[model samples]
Structure formats: C-alpha cells, structure tokens
Target chain A: MISIDKYAYNSRLRRRDPMQKLVFAMMTLSVCIWAEKIIISIAVIFIMGGMTVLKGGTPFPFFLRLLLVPMIFLLVGVFTIAVNICENQEMLLWAIPFAGKWIGFSDASLVKSLKLFLRALGAVSCLYFLSLNTPMVDLLAAFRRLGMPKVFVELMELVYRFIFSLMETADTIYNAQNCRLGYSSLCSSYRSLAIMASMLFIKSYKQSKALYTALEARGYEGEINVLEEAYESHWGWYIMAVAVNALLVLFVIALKSITGGLS
Target chain B: MNENILETKDLHYIYADGAVALKGISIGIKKGKCTAVLGANGAGKSTMFLNFNGIYRPSSGQVLFNGKPIDYSRKGLKELRRKIGMVFQDPDNQLFSASVFQDISFGVVNMKLPEKECRRRVDNAMEQIGITHLRDKPTHSLSFGQKKRVAIAGVLAMEPEVLVLDEPTAGLDPIGVSELMKMLRQIQTTLGITVVISTHDIDIVPLYCDYVFVMYHGMMVLEGTPKQVFTQKETIRDINLRLPRIGHLMEILKYKDDFDLDDSINTISEARIALKDWKARYLKR
Candidate 1:
C-alpha cells in the first residue's frame, strides 16, 4: 500500500487528468467484469499491466507482486467453484469417493472457475492501474468532481493524510517502548502494545482538535474547499481509452460468437 | 484609529477542563512588523495565539483587529480569518491535505476567490517558499523543514494582513532555522504582511524581530524592542527564558570581562561593531 502511494506521486502518468484516468479505469473494469471471457481477461490484464509498468513507470515486478496478492484468495474461492459433490461422475476430471457419492472436479465447473478467477484478477488490475498513477489527493478530487458528497471526500482526504501520521506515531511509540524494555516479556509486550494503541487514539484526538483549530483559523468554515490543481488534459488519452475499451468489447463479442459464449 | 493591527485586550481563555490557559494577555501587534512573542513551555503562548483570530473566544475581554473588536459570527469569522491567518507549530497538524499544491490552495479557495486567482496565489505561494519543485510531492514524503515551509505557504496564499505562526522554528536545523526566518522576514516586508510568531528561539529574536513581547504565566512580563527586552536579563531568567547567545556574550564581556561595551547588543553584527569600537578606544587609552 505504501509503495503504491509512493509510486502514485512519482508515476509518469501522474500529470494526466484524474477524471480521465478514473473514467478509463472504471470503464475497463466494468467491461472486464461483464465480458467474462478468459481471452478478454487476459487482454485486460495486459492492458492494465502495460499501462502501469510501461506508461506509469511502476516496476514490472512490483505490479506482478501486487497481482499475485489476490491470487491466493482467488485460488481458494475458485477451488470451491471448480470442485463439486455429484452422484453422476461421467464428466468428472478427478474424483474422490465420499459419503456414498463422489466429490470431484467437473469440466464445466473447472472452466467456470477459470473464467471467474481471471475476470476478478483483471478487474483488480484495472484498479491497480488507477491507484498506481493517481495519488489519493487527485483521486479524491476526481471523486469530488464526480459529485461525491463533500463530507465524504473531506473525510477521505483527511483520513488518507493522517494515516501516515498515525503510523509514524505508532512506530515512534513502539521504538520508545522497545528502548524502555517494555516488550521484554510476552505479557509485557501485550501491555505495551495496548498502551501504545490507546496513546495513539488520544494523540489522534488531540491532533484532530489542533487540525480543526488550524483549519478554522484559515477560514475553513466547515468545508474543505481546496482548489483542484490543473492537470494535463489530452483528448488523445480519452480517444485511446475509448478505442481500447471498444476493441476489448469487440474481442469479447467475437469470442462469444466463436465459442458459443465463454460463460 | 489605532496603528496596531491586532490587539488582545485583557483576553482570557479557560478550557472546559477548568484549566485557565490565559489570565489576561493585552498586547498590540504593530502592522507590517515582525513581532516575536517569547515564552517558555505552557506559558499560554499557544492559547493566546488561538485568541488572535477568534479561534478561541476570550472568556473575559476582546480581540481587536485594526482597533475593532472581532465579530464572532460565522460570516464575521470568515472575513476575520482572511485578514489574520494563523499557522500552527506542527506542520503535520497544519497540513491536512496530502498534496502540497492542494494544501496551499485551501485557504485561498475557502476565501471564495475565482479559480484562476486561487491557482495564481497557490503558485505564487509555492514560489515564495521555494517549494515549487515540491508542488507535486505528497505531504508525507517531505522532510520536517520542507513541511514547515509548506505550512507557512498554506497561510501565505491567503494573503492575510497578519500572519501568526506559533513557534515557526521549533524543530529545525541551524541552517533551516536561519533560512526559514529569513524567508518569513522577506515575506513580511515584501508582501507588507504583519508577522507575529511565538518562539523560545531567543537568538533569532534579536536578529529577526522588530518588536518583542515576553509572556509568562499567561500575562505580559515585558514588551519592547529586542534590544530592550534581552537587556532585562534577570526578568527574562525569572520567566525561565534567557537572553540571546550573543547578548549573553556581550553581557559577559561588559561585567565579567570588565570590557566597556554597550549593554544592549544582542546580535552578532552589533557585538562585532561594539567590540571593534571597544578595541580602538582601549588601545588608544
């Protein structure tokens, strides 16, 4: 998460208009979910990966690592869908006898799980592409432009910024405790961790109070009305995004016609 | 009309927890001048600053801007804040936005300026603070000194009549301290903004501040130019503060070293000038 945030700030595509990025990511994601074809999913993955690693300048290995993060959950989830308990086992690829019946992988279930897993991964990659290029500030700004409620955007902005501060505070508290031998024993470790958590809560409360006063002093007047910074807007990026998504849709249609429906 | 831009007339604030942070703080901040409020820890410096722009309503007296008592209404507070911007000590607290550009634009945007005007001011503020290179950087990635500059820029973009910074150089390296103070001095004079800062960094007080107000126990212990304030060494020491390092050196040279030098020299340049004069006179004698 931290790496993603750092990359977002330094991303080569960071200057791109956030709304354009948001539109591109969300549109591709929805299409990827709707298409439900392994080929289309593969295409989405490659598109998002290429955008993030090549254009966005994120390290390819990092992108792959992030893509692998959800595979564990996807594998387990798809495993259940791929395996089934059945009385008739003619289509079973692998079977185990259990409870006077058979539990095994069937051809249809295996194909279904494969498509499901790939589709989910493709959707996640689309999100990664967006997050890897757009900083939280810009994303929140995009959301604000999208007519998300002011309070919600404000909360998100504050939460996003303070998460770093809270983590730093927690780290400092942990180090201070370590120097004092507060974590010498298991019992003491639990006590120290608990104390640190509570101290962080108190500290955060104080910080929020201070932030409120500071904001109020700056004519906050209850709304965090910050100017949206101008980004490099290009009609070419919009055209490319539409053309690419259109091709993905056409490919999905061709696959549906050729395979008589990938689902 | 009074020449003072900001005045707290016997202002008092007691927190809900029943702790009286200020008994009475009455001080007039001169316009277009750098005023340093000198105080030790928990000496009500922060509390008094909160009162400066009506962030904390005084329980007893009044806060005056340009000799007029502040209106605490919502609309009135908004106007007051536009004229009197306050920058806190902790950059982390002051910088609520992740992006430096967005954070700097907050004040200007809140003032309901045109979008183009807001952008211009934000860009100008970043340029003034020499953080235009950091315009795209996240707040978390900035170093302590950079964050401090961003916080000041956040207030300066508003183009306030008076900029109140609490401990503007609390946790800075020596060079960072000098650079930040110098930039603030430039901002004050160049933009014609009245700058008020509360700090324990006494050495810079003599070099930077035109007027000084010493706060002890929530009340003004002394108020004068830096030369006059630092010369009252015993009263400063009573308040758990001290003279500037150069002033202390000059004091030693006058009393302990039995050298004939001015008692009011608090900065290095003045000490140098005084020492050269002393040397010429002593050698001739």
Candidate 2:
C-alpha cells in the first residue's frame, strides 16, 4: 500500500487532473467488462498498462508486478468454473471417468474461463492505471467535485491523513515488543499481537478525540470545509479520454459485426 | 485598549471525570509579543490554551480577547477562532486532510472569505513558513519538521491576531527546535501576531521568548521576562523545571569555580559576553 502511494506521488502524471484519469479509467473498465470478449479485454489491458508505464512514468516491472497481484485469485476462481462434471463423456475435451460421469473442462468452459480471467485482469489494470498516476488526495478531491457525499469525502480525508501516523505508531510498538523478546515464540507472538491490537484501538480512540479537539480549534463547525485545490487542467484531456473510449467502443462494434457476436 | 491580546481571569477547568486540569489560572498575553508558557508534563498548559480559544469553556472564569470577554455563542466562537488560531503539537491530529495546500486553506475557507483571498492567504502562509515547495506534497510524505511547518502554515493562513501553539517544539530535533523557534519569532515580529508557545525546553525560553509564564499544577506560579522568571530558581526546580543550561553553568562558574561571572546569564551569547568582561577585568592581575 505504501509503495503504491509512493509511486503515485512520484509519477509524472501526479499533477494531471484526477477527474480526467478517473473518467478514462472508469470508461475503459466498463468497456472491458461490457465487451465480454477476450481480445477486447487484452486490448484494454495493454492500453491502460501503456498509459501507466509510458505516460505516467511508472516502472514497467512494477506495473507488471501489480497486475500479477490478482492473478492467484483469478486462477482459482477460473479453475472452479472450468472444471465440471458432464453427463455426455464425449463433450469433455480432456476428462476422467468418475462413477459413470466425465469430469473435465469442455471447449466452451475453457473459452468462458479465459474470457472471464482476462476481463477481470483488464478491469484491474484500469484501476491500477488510475491509482498509479493519481494520489489519494487528488482522487478524493475529484470525488468531491463529482458530488460525492460531503461526510464521506471528509471521512476519507481524515482516514487518509491518519493512516501514516497510525502505521508509524504501530511500527514503534512492534519494535518495542521485539526488543523485549515478546515475539521470541509463536505463542508469545500471538499474545503480543493481541496486546498491540488492543493498544492500537485505544490509542486511535484517544487520537480521534484529540483530532476532534484540534479541528474544533480551527472553527470546524460540523463540516470539514476546505478549499478545493485548482489543477492545471484543460478540456483537451477530457476530449482525449472521450475519443479513446469511443475508438474502443467502435472496435468492439466492428469486431462484433465482423465475427457475428462473441463466438 | 489594554496591551494584552488575550487574558484568562481565575480560569479553572475540571474534566468530566472529576480531574482538575487548571485551577484559577490568570495571565495576560501581551499584544504582538512572543510569550512562552513553561511547564512540565500535566501542567494544564494545553487545557488553558483550549480555554483561550473557547474550545473548553472554563469552569468558573472568563477568557478575554483584546480586553473583551470571549463570546461562546456559535457565531461568536467562529469569529473568535478565526482571530485566534491554535496549532496543536501533533501535526497529524491538526492536519485533517492529506493535501498540504488544502489543509492550509481549511481554516481560511471556514471564515467564508472570497475564493481569491483564500488562495492568496494560503499561498502567503506557505511562503511565510518556507513551505511553498511542500505545498504540493501530501501531509504523510513530509518529514516531521516539514509537517510541523505545514501545521503552522495551516493556522497562519487564517491570519489570526494571536497564534497559540501547544508544545510547538515537543518532538523536534535540536536544530529543528531552534529553526522553528526562529521562524516563529520572525512571524511574531513581522506579522505582529501575538505568539504563545507552551514548552519545557528551558534554553529556548530566554533565547526566543520576550516574556514567560510558568505553570505548575494548573496554576500560574511565575510570570515575568525570561530573566525575572529564571531568577526564581528554587520555585522553578520545585515544579520539576530547571534553569537553562547556560544559567546552570554560569551559576557553577560563579560559585563552585570562584569565577566573577554573572550568575543570571541564561543564554549562550549573554554568558559569552559576561565571561569576556570577566577575563578583561582579571587580566589586570
């Protein structure tokens, strides 16, 4: 999580308007899911990956590693969908006989699983493109501009600010415990973790109260009203986003017309 | 009008759980002057500060701003908070937003100022704290010293008449402490904003603060210039505080080492000048 945040801040696209990125990522994600075609999914993945690495200056290896994060879950889910019992033994492409049944992946199941896997990956890549290029603060600001609930955005802002402090505190506590041999044994490790967790909860509670007091001192009368930072944005980025998504849609339409549907 | 920008009269604060934090404390913070509230842990300096901004209503006393009692009404409190910005010690607690620029603009925006004016104040405050480079950085990405500056910038943008900082130098390094104090002194002098900081850093008191108030067990035990306050050595030590290191050294030189140096010299430069004069006098022998 920290690495992603760090990369986002350091990315060349960090100063770009977050709304444009949000629109582009969401549009591509929906297109990837809606097209339901393996080729389109692959195209969407490449488009987002190129945008993140080439334009945003995120390292290609790092982007590839981030893409692989969801692969394990996708493979497990796709495996369940691919392997199934069939009444007709001849329907199974590669099957084993099991108590008067055939259990294996058929050609249709394999295609469906492959499409689902790519679609999931493609959607994930779209989000990664957005997150890799835009800091959470910028994203939250974009959400506020999009008319997200005021309280929701404020809560996110506070949580985002305190997350680092909480992490630092947790690190300090863990180090203190380690120095005292609190984690010498597995049993003691569990004990120490529980104690730390409870301590963290209490500490955060007190911190919240203190934060409230601090906010009040600044004249926070119920709402966390802050000035929205102005970004050096132009309509050109939105236009480009729309034009790219239009091309994707046209490509999907042309493919559907040419192939006469997903099959 | 009175010279004091803020004053607390017989202020007492009792927590809901029956713990007394401040007991009838009264002190006047002079307008446009830097003041230090020296205290040990649990000295109720923070509680008293909250009372100044009307965050915690005193149990049985009045907090006067500019010789007029603070208005506790919602609208009045808002106006008062706008003029008396309070920067908490922990930047994390004070900076509620991840964005440095936005966090700095928070207090100013609450004042319902025009958009352009708000932007100007935020930019000016960032420049004042020497954090224009950090304006685009997230609060979490900043170092502790940078975050401290950002926190101060956040309050400074409000253009408050009196800036109250609770333990401003608490978690800073030695250089950070001096740098921050110097920056604050610059702000106080240039902006003419009355500044009050609560700290146990004895050395900085004489070097930076024009006047000092010593708090012990929620009561005001001493109030004077740094020189006058540090002269009450016995009382200061009884409250678990101490003279500045230079003052201690000068005391030893004058008494233990039989040097004819001034014992009241608390700051480094003062001790240096005093030792130079003593050497000049002793050269005749």
Candidate 3:
C-alpha cells in the first residue's frame, strides 16, 4: 500500500487535474441517483471499470476492496426491508404467518430495495475510480488552486502530517511492547494497549512541540506558503466525461418519460 | 579577543515545570571557528544551543548577536534566526517537508529570497551535500543518512554566518558520523562560517573543534583550547566524558618514561608517531 503511494503510475486519468476527477465523480453519482434504470447504472460502472483496466495496472484488488464497502450497505438495506415485511401495505406476492401477523413481501418493495442497492454501488464505484487514479498530494494541490482558504489547506496538510507522525509513534510503542513480552499473553496485551495509549499521547505532545520549534526555525510566520497553479481541463477529456454523465442523465429523462407515459 | 558573533551573558533558563536547564551560563562564540560545547545528558548543552538561535528565550540575562541584544519582537528574532542556522539532532524533525527539494528550500523560502535565487541556493546546497539526486524524492522515503544530509542542506541553503548543531551525529552509524563530520568541516573551512556544535563525543572535540567548552551541572565549568581542557582528566571525568583516545594512550605512556609529552594529539597517526619517537628517546637515554 505504501509502495503504491510512493511510486508514480502511468495513467491519463492520473495526470488529469483532481478537480476534474472530482467533478466527474459528482456528475456520475448524481446521474446514478436520478436515473432509476439499472441498465444505465451498470453501463456507467462498466465504463469506469474499463478505464481502470486500460490504465495498464492490476486494479482488481483495489476494486474488490472498494466494492466490499458498498456491499455491506446494500446488505443492510436488503435486511432492513426484508425483516420489516409485516406492516408493509401492498399486494402480497409472498406471505408467511409470524407472531400473529401475516409477514408479507411485495414485488415493488424488492424492486425498490434492489434499485437503492445498485444506485449506492454505482456511486461508490465512481468515487473509487476517481480516488484510486489520483495522487492525494496533487489532489490537495488542486483543492488549493480551487481557491480554498489558505488556512484550511494548511490545516489539512498539517493534519495529514500529524497522522503519519502518530503512526510512527504507535509503531515504536508497539515494538517496545513486543520486545518486553508485553503481548505474550492476552491479558498482557490488553494492559500493553492501555499503557501504549498513554505513552503515545505524551510522546505526541512532545513531538508536537518539537515540530513547532522546527517550523519556527524554518521561519514559519503563522501561514504556510503554497504554490498556486491553474488546472487546465482538457477539452477532449472534459467532453468524454460529460458524455458519460449525459448518458446517465438521458436514461433518467427516459425513465421519467416512461413513467409519465404509463400514468 | 576576536569579534564575538554570539555572546550569552549569564543566561539562565528554567522549564515550565521548574527544572533549571541553564544556570548563570556565559559564553563568547567567536566567528570563523568551530567551538564545541561538550557535556553529558542533562548538562544543558542543548539548552545553550537553543539560546543561540532564540528557540529558548532565557529566563534571565541577555543573548546578544553581533553586539546587539535579541529583542522579543518577532521580526527581530526572525532576522536573527536567518543569520544563525540551526541543524537539529533529529533529521526527521528538521526535514519535514514533503519533498527533499521543498525541505532544502524551506529556509530559503522563509528568508523570502527570490524564486530563482531560492532554486539556485537549493541546488548549490544539495550539490554541496551530494544529495541533488534526491531533489524530487519525498523526504519520508529517504534513509536516515540521506535525511541528515538533506537537513544540513536545508540549513546550508539559508547561508547563515553561524551554524548551530545539537548532537548532529547522535544516533548515526560510524559512516554517517564520518560523513556528517566531513561535511561540517568542509562547510566551516570553505565558507569560514562560525560552527557551534554541542556533543557528548569527546574525541570529536580535538579533531574538529578549534575551541571547547565543558559543561557540568547546568554551567560552563571549563572553557579553553581542546588541549587545555582534555589534559584536565579530573574535570573531564566529572563531566562523565572520557579523555580523547590519544590523551588516554599518552597517560599510559607517561608511566614508562620520564620525558615530557603533549597530551593534545588529535589523531591516531599522530599518537602512533609520538609514541614511537618517545620510546626511541627513552631507549637512548
């Protein structure tokens, strides 16, 4: 995982400005939400997946990881609707007597649940495609260029740095505990975790002071200086992204038209 | 007697928890000389170096740079700091920039140098430390030795007249230590910058320091040439530091011969030759 972040990969999608990817992600998500057609959502997912594969990298594991998160949400929605079938007021396609009431399942409810699940999956997939292709630093730089306040951007950078520093401290504490056989037994491991937490807090406080001193020595006068660059969105890539979004939009319009025509 | 680039007059500092770190310490750091502050842990060597760069304002007394007292004004301190570059003990703390190039250019950028000038200085400093290849690399990816070199490059880019280092070789392997020492010596000699080093390594004093100050119990106990201080075995031992290797070997030789010998040999080769010459003279007598 660390190596993936460290080494630069070749991808046209990766080279595009993060702001562009962010916009594309939002557009795809909104289209997925509005369009009730599963076919259109599936088409959008296929296009994003194709881009991942064509980037000449094995993104299958990352894709699986991304998919697993949304799968949980989909399962939750399915189970919630499945368990509360008793009070549902529609024509029953299936019914089972439970606790003195006819626990009924309807075709419309099932279809609604499945639609919500697919919409969520489509949205998550779009976000995964955007994040997996873009480096975080460049993304943050893009945010800075998007006219975000300097203080907020600097705070974000500092927070990112602090997370890594905390991780290092945690690693050191874990190693020290391991060396002392603190984790040899389950009881000892619990005790070690508590002690490590306290130690980590103290160490982090000291490190924060050291970091401040270091920053002051380097002439940090209350604000971090960030270089600004204009994100030139390529017309071709922008058009392609828009076209992908427009397909989903048109599908929604078609769905609305069909529903209206049926009514 | 020389112009004191940095002078601390009875500087005393106590931590917020009331632990006295520096007690009535006075020292004159001259320009264009490598002056080492030698002491053991808790002897207040680091406290003194912090004072040199205004990292710690003394609880009492004054810190003067170029005959002017350091004002509490932020602008004054920043200007003073620009003239006194500090290389911290941990390179990890010092080189925190995302990339090596940004880390090296940090002080330059802080000094508000022109973009082209900053780039030029960063390139020159990296070239000096032989780390130009690491320019675009993230700092977190570099090895400890490389990080130390980058930290030094960061400070060197500032082009300060006085360089203050606190245990620059601490936690370093022998090669890293040697590489750091070579770089420090080169910088001091070529640029004629005032180099103030605080270290626990006694052997480094004779080899690199033009003047040495021995600190004990939060005070500067002895100050003189390395030769003068190292010969005082009791004082060196009191500070929990060993005599330099050559001085230790000379002590052993003194028992065998009644001839006068200097206890200030700085290198192994010098000690070897001196031992051979002394033995030859003793045999003749």
Candidate 4:
C-alpha cells in the first residue's frame, strides 16, 4: 500500500545538493533574524510557507499541526506576562492586590510581551519549515560538503539512525511482550519495561557487532560514502529561488527602515 | 570439485553474559552451493552464521576465508568480510539506509568503487531483485517482503562470493515466503554465488537447498542432502523437529495397504500425483 512516489520526494530534495540548500537556508535565516518589524517577519513566513507548499506538497493542515506546539508556548508566555504585571504602574488594567500586587496587568507591558511573542513565533515558523521540508540526509550531506568535520557528520548520521532504530526495537519488544501476555497489571508493566530495556541493550550490542561486520563485508575502510550524486540547480530554478529570497530579504530591510523612520 | 571458499575450525563463541552461543563447531562451506542450516530456537544457528564474516571472534578457534585464518586486526577482518556479505534475520536491521538506492549502494561505496561503477552495481542489484522502481523510496516505508528484497539487493551490490542469510523466510506469509524462495533460487542459479542460509523452515530446504546442516545445542547434529536428512524421521524427532508435510503424508500412505504408492515421494506435488494415480487404479479395479 506504500506509494514509492511519496517517499521519492525526499530523495529528490536530497538530489538538490545539500550545500546549495544550506546556503539558501542560511540566507533566508539571516534575513529573518535581522528583520525587526512584525510585517517583515510575517512576509518572510508567508513567502517560505508558499514555497514549501509548492515544493513539498505539504498541506495547510500539516503546517497547522507544526505550529500548534509553538502556539501553545506563545499563549503561555502571553498569559504569564499578562497575569504578573508590576504594581505602581500608570493606568493599570487589573490588580488582584493580594499581598501587595502579587498579580496585576499593564497595557504597556502587555504590548511589549505581545511583540516578543510575535518574534518567537516568527523564529519558530522558520525553523519548522527548515526541519520538516528539508530531508535530514540532504542536510548532513550539505554539512559535509561545507567542510564540516567528518566525525561530526558521522556522529549526526549515527545518532539520527540510532533514534529510529531504537524506536523500532522498542516497538518490536512491545509487540513480542503483548503476544506473550507479559503485561496484565501495573507491576507486570514495570517488569516488562525493565525486560524491554535489558533486551534492547543486548540486541543493540549484538547489532553493533553485526553492523560492523556488514560494513566490513562491504569493504568499508573508515570512510562512509553516500551514493548521492549532486546536481546543480537549473539556472532558471536557481534564479527563481535566489530572486525570491533576495526580494524577501530586501523587503524585510525596507520594512525595517520604514518602521525605524516612523518611530 | 569446487574449492572450499570458507571453513570454520572448532569455532567457539560465548555471549558477554556467559551464554555459550557456539561450541567447538567445525564446518567447511563449499563454493557455489546453497547450504541450509536448520535448527530450532536457541540452537546457535545464528552464532555460527555470524562467524562467517568475523562478527564474533571464536573464543578459542578460528575461521579461515580462502584458507587464510581470519585475523581480528582491522585490515585483516575488513578483507575477509568484504568477500562474504550477510543479510541479517531482520530486514529492518540490514536496510537502515534512508532510501533503497542508498541502502543498495552502501556496500559498494564502502568498497570504494568508482562512482560510475557503484551506480552500475546498484542498478544491476536492484534490477536483479526487481526493485529498481523502489530506488528513490525510503526504506522504512516498504513492506516486510519488499524490505527483505532490498536487503538482499544491498548485499548483492557488494558482489560478495558468499551470501549468508539468517532466517531469510522467517515472519513472512506463505506467499511472501514462496516469493522470497523463488528470488533466492534465481539469484543462486543466475549469479552462481554460494549461499548459506539458517532457517527453521524445513519445507523450504527441499525446494531450494543443495545441502543441509542440522544444529542442536551449539553443534551440528546432522548434515546431508535434503533427501537424506528428511528421510531420517528419528533424527528429526530427536531434535524436536518435524519432517516436511509431504514426507509425513508419504509415510502415512505407506502404512495404508489400500494406497499402493512409491515410498519416494519427496514433494507435495509429487505426493498429490501419487495419490491421484492410486485413486485411479483403485477405482478401475
């Protein structure tokens, strides 16, 4: 039932040399960071979102789900700041006056907190795009091409692979336990957890040895080469990407300048 | 006679926790023959298979590849391992690369082959396994059968002399098992690569293997052709194993006087034909 085409999209991104994507990401990120005005941040977010939707076939619902986490944090920050305003403030919105201003609110502080929340949201949105749209393999490959230390890239690859593998092993152990009726009570669940952990340790140890053997069998001599052929972006695609990003960067600068002038 | 490409000399292995996995096992794997190692759970079939590529160094014994003892030194082990590719029991363990193409190319890249040659081998391996269409697909999303095929392709890309598989057909549905057996048979015939597989599936051995090794308690208890091994009902019973269903049915037919049939029916289809012929003769009478 699995569609190969759906999975192929990730590799297609990988084909777009990691180095180019990294450069593109850095350029976009730097602009996002420097743009102080909310309008500019919102503009960059919308632009990036549109492009991701086009390239990744990602839906609005997917973006909504990703934003849900940061949205909660933003709400919490807003609520905390709104509830814990300092006393002796001019034009206080509300005051509990419990034990001398334990809880109060001020319009000025509220506006300032809202601005901070917006900035945080903007940063989070940019990160979500980068992490979700860009394949991790391509990112690591780009890092390697950028002259990052081999050991660092290797460590990253191993760590990423290990997380997925460990999860799979855990799932298998859980299934095996379920089949054996290993968990019927709270005590049994605790026992199952311990057993699962021990089994994972043993299995991981064995797999490490087996993996090394498999690697050696393939003529591995310390160097791990991925069979990724880097493709240069078409001039048209490069220009489009660069032009769009450059325009956003310039727009952010212009918006910031306007905000400064107005202030 | 073909030369012995791999041999184990009293190879012994114990787990870190002191469980003896293999105990003084000695066997020579002949080149270009499909050897099936059959054993029950905890019979050390896997431990013995792991020794082929020096995954586990024997406690006191030795493994020799091409008549040279496998040394634990990095260079020596790497050289020995490169010639004997293994597909683990779990396809998930073997197919860890992000995409099918990357998984297949992993061994080739490890070999440090030229990029063009590596691509050619990856293409060829995928084609051989009929998974060329899955090249760009993420391996995690594949079915168990598809993942197993990808695992085999990964090993095939390495072009090792011996392909050691641990329980290749385990956990597969009937159709998947047959399909995998068919693929393994094709690879053996077309590539002429030596294959050593460990499995509890006695049913598959008669159909695919040229020789069988039955292990029990960390030692090989029986070794022979499938015909020879399956005909020994007592030995199979001693090891807590059963004969193939066809063999069992053949024995039952011999016990019944009304069914006059040859005692040598070795496969289910042959048994079916024998039953049909008996029915026809009896109905005529």
Model number with the top DockQ: 1
DockQ scores of the candidates: 0.83, 0.82, 0.27, 0.45
Report residue B3 deviation for candidate 1 (angstroms).
2.3
lDDT of 4 at B88: 84
- Alpha-carbon lDDT, every model: 0.91, 0.92, 0.78, 0.76
Tens digit of per-residue lDDT, candidate 4, span A1-263: 12222332552354665465555556666666665556656766776666556665666676666667678878987777766645564557776666665467777667667666766666666665566555666677678777899989877876665666788889989999978887878888899989999999998888877676566656667776778754556566556668867887777667558767442
Candidate number of the best TM-score = 2
Question: What lDDT tens digits, residue by residue, belong to model 3 across residues B1-285?
Answer: 549999999999999999999999999998888999999998998888888788899999999998889876888889988889988888767755565666677788888878888878888988988998886565666788888888888888889999999898888898778778878988999989899999988777888788998899899999999888887888788768888877887776665664466666656877878878878988999
**Of 2 and 4, the candidate ranking higher by DockQ:** 2
DockQ of predicted candidate 2? 0.82
Which regions in candidate 1 have their CA more than 4 angstroms from the true location?
A86-90, A96-103
Q: After superposing candidate 4 on the true structure, give the runs of residues whose Cα lies further than 4 Å from its correct spot.
A: A1-15, A78-111, A169-206, A220-223, A229-232, A235-238, A252-262, B1-3, B8-28, B57-76, B256-258, B276-285
For candidate 1, lDDT tens digit of each residue in B137-184? Answer: 999999999999999999999998999999989999999999999999
Ranking 3 against 4 by DockQ, winner: 4
TM-score of chain B of each: 0.98, 0.99, 0.94, 0.93
Model 2 per-residue lDDT tens digits across residues A1-263: 89899899999988888998999899889988998988889999999999999999999999999988999999999999999899898898999989998899999999999999999999999999999999998999899999999889888988888889889999999999999999999999999999999999999999999888988888888998888777769999889888888988898899899989856
Please give, for residues A1-263, the per-residue lDDT of candidate 3 as tens digits: 45345432234455566787777777887787777667767876776666665662536666667578669768987767754455544466787777766676677667767777777777777766766666555566777778899778777766655566678779988999999999999999999999999998888778778877977887878776633223446777677779988876876687768788231
Clashes of 1: 0
What's the best-to-worst order under TM-score? 2, 1, 4, 3
